[model samples]
Target: MAAPAGDNVQLTDGEERAISSYFGFDCLYDHQRKVISDTLLSKDVFLSTKTSSGKSLCYQSIPVVYQHRQLPVIVLVISPLLSIMEEQVHLLRAMGFTATVIGKDPKENNDIKTGKYSFLYTNPETVLKDDEWREVLMTEVYRKTVRLIVVDEAHTVTQWGTSSTEEVFREWFGRLGELRSLLPGIPMLAITATATNINRRKIKQKLCMMNSIDYTESPDRNNISLFVSEIPHAKPLEEVFGWLVTAAKQNSCPRTVVFCKSIGDTAKVYGMFVRELAGCHREIVNMYHSCTLPNIKEKIRANMNDIDGSLQILICTNAAGMGVDFKGVQSVVNYGPPQELDTLIQQLGRAGRDGSQSLHILFYKNNK
Candidate 1:
């Protein structure tokens, strides 16, 4: 996999070869090349691209570029979901890159202090409150070799960070502002799959990136056909159950995800399917939420990704959908309206990721 001719000039010959080989792509998408080129030139960048648009490549390429230079450069990625952080670390390690997720383990501390890892992944709370990790960051090795900092799911800085109701998120994510003051010159990259104009402005302000370059693409998924319907208040559950049965039974739409607002609803929907869809469909149904055990969650994610597996349908809360890529999901059923429009878009983006035609159905109770 060689880089295409006349690609961005900022990438050195070694860096270009590394990107091409690591990703198995002859050339990066135009936007990805621009991001890597700009970040290499020491510019702040905010990417508001669609899901599955190769946004991670924009920042992931940074460490590879520096690693090619035979430098001890490290890239710190602040991600919100433990699942996402773990997944990225696993992929990098599989690619023969030294990457670690921040944890309470003493070995992680030693690894950081010795400058043995090329990439570190952690959440905002861990970096802000962990005394040992903070000390590691302040060390001369980190101060000198750390080349880039990435904020994945940057929309959360406003959606969750400043929530008037979620005190925990505010307390933790609010500290993002201090990052600029702590590491003044290192380039910051904020990437999210969905963001409104207002959210874009808020994210830049909260992250203290007034001079950041902005890249945006429409959030529309043309392959996903959207449908909205109002169910009678008294029979909303029955209506939803029937729809799920029909959708799963349709051979054209085999893989499906039903997003409920609460864990209780997820359990109820899952139980109903287990009891009602008594044959092959019953065997394929499962539930996922924050309370689902980590091991079970991992298995569920793996099964969802197995195109040939019996696990074809998953009823889950919002937590189940974030940053977890399931490429075979052909249908997304929203049990009710999403809390907000951006959330709706994110959930819908999960389906049809393989670029095949998909369905997104939204069901709401009629107020009348």
Candidate 2:
């Protein structure tokens, strides 16, 4: 959903009630209402706003509206991470919406073809490469009933498009535009929290959304306070992290996520905490990166989403912090100044998502 590209961006009485009742909100924000209205007209939308700003509701409400009118419509959501798809599908089911990931849920495959799910969540790879998914998209049922295609964390289309790392590790991100021909004439809703003018241009080009309606909001979270400090690397390790170590000892450290630049840094930091905390490291901390096992990553995700879970501190690279909404991360620590501004904004945006007062502390080392 986004700003109106055409006239008459108004929601019908039934549509408005469907949105508010299902999401349990008194009223929709101005941007939200504008997005939902524009989307109803089947307009492309690029929504760039801060995290926790109800971006999910923008696209989620579309199928809700169609369902209310007794229309059999499905929204295809192409997300970056499987964890993100799984997490959102779970929440959607809890909210009484029919949504499911295509793969990994073998039992749901038949249901998906029957158009039982209002939303189908899958990665770009499956969208571009999977033969079975290709056949499903070609079916008369999908072509007639699939009204919209959503690209979540859409900034990655641009971020990965020009990166050499993608060529070696995963090239499916850069090729997301191919979905356009597969699902011709269907509008796309691209949502992200960390795209600038340059990034937006690239994303639009990558997704072939040159005429997409734009809904830009100030990327500000009022409850988050930011501070940057220089770390004297010459000092002993104990002197640098001793404060957190002590806080961990008292079991008073707030739920925190430490963003390191490299997987090795995550491991090093995770080891330090484990060593200082004695035998309780397993109960207090964990590390995540691209190399982490799938089951372990799922477990870590579960723990992070549980406010009362034993694992509290997470040290990881860029892998774990993308689009999933962790339960309550009160503190965000960037181990070093990220080379890119969007990365910094995204990492810090993870805080205050639960609406609690949060802190973003970045520690950098001098080059000289």
Candidate 3:
């Protein structure tokens, strides 16, 4: 592990060169470069960079340089949502990396045990539940194989409150000591796109990761336009109706994602799609959320990918936005405001992944 020289905290020449080569970029955003170099020195880092700002590169680069001259059994990425895990695996595989998903894709369980992958992404809850996986993870094979443990969406673990089940909280509630006993001196990295002051402290305490540093990139997107509408006793359905009408009349064909705040809201939005869009209005659209059956959700996701303009309007909740990609989605309609600004940003981020002009509109009503 290398240390930052002198009082200057800038990346060393070697670190800069390595990052540039791996990501095919001239330089890391100041935040990304710092986190990467700091983690390379074996320091645990907690960061709040925006989605698609290259936070994954922090750990992705770490394994390349700090694997101790041995192939890491795998880099374990603990993500909170299935959408994010699925999206990450897709992105990593596209990059020509040997990334395997443990929680999803059951067939890959055997592959994980064979230690054939460079990265294994799973949720913390899943990691703790299966004693069999835990046993292997505690073994020398895993010790030599895993170079770093990454906690993506680390804020969720703390802000959502700790689970009573040990398996779910094992990684957070002081169980790291036991695991560290087996694989002594392995580094941990906790990454999030948003963390309040309290969330930051809870993350360090829960993960038992000391000497932690935080990196936050400004949440400003010059290309993105933001609008917030505050209404009193606002009917969310009516909001969606107006947004769709306005969008449909726009000069350009812009895809839109309508985000509801709850499952019940999702039902209403889905119904609105069928009644307002598909039935009376004759609009082509689809709906998705966790409450939807798995098969149904799959069909919706597949439908959204139709490049020939088969699927145009997507009505969903936060459940569908995590890592799912809907290319050329130019607009995101928030039927109801998100609980937090960070979540709002993540949901809005799905629209602009293609770097095109994206629009985020929030509709909120003050019941009081």
Candidate of highest TM-score:
1
Cand. 3 TM to true fold: 0.80
Each model's lDDT: 0.81, 0.83, 0.68
* Candidate 1 RMSD computed on C-alpha atoms after optimal superposition onto the true structure: 4.4
Winner on lDDT (1 vs 2) = 2
lDDT of 2 by residue, 1-368 (tens): 22122223356877788789888888888888888887777778999989888888988887777776677888899988887888899988998889899877788889888888899999888868898987888777777778778999887886765575436345787888888887777788999998889889888898999899999877888899999988886765566678777888888988889999998888888888888888765588889998999999999999888878787789999888798677788889998877668888999988888789999999888767
lDDT of 3 by residue, 1-368 (tens): 22212212334777577657876988777777777667655567788777668777887775455333333436788776766676677778887678977846678777787777888887655666667777767766666667668887776666454655444433443343244554456667888767767767876887777677877766666667999887667555656376575445452347778898988877777776566554434445777877778777766776666555556677787778665667677788887788667678778877776677888888877779
Candidate 1 residue pairs that clash: none
Better of 1 and 2 by TM-score: 1
Q: How close is candidate 2 to the true structure, as a TM-score?
A: 0.92
List model 1 lDDT by residue over 31-109, tens digit each: 9988898877767899999989999988888767866766667888988888888888888999888898888366577
Better of 1 and 3 by TM-score: 1
Index of the highest-lDDT prediction: 2
lDDT of 1 at 352: 95
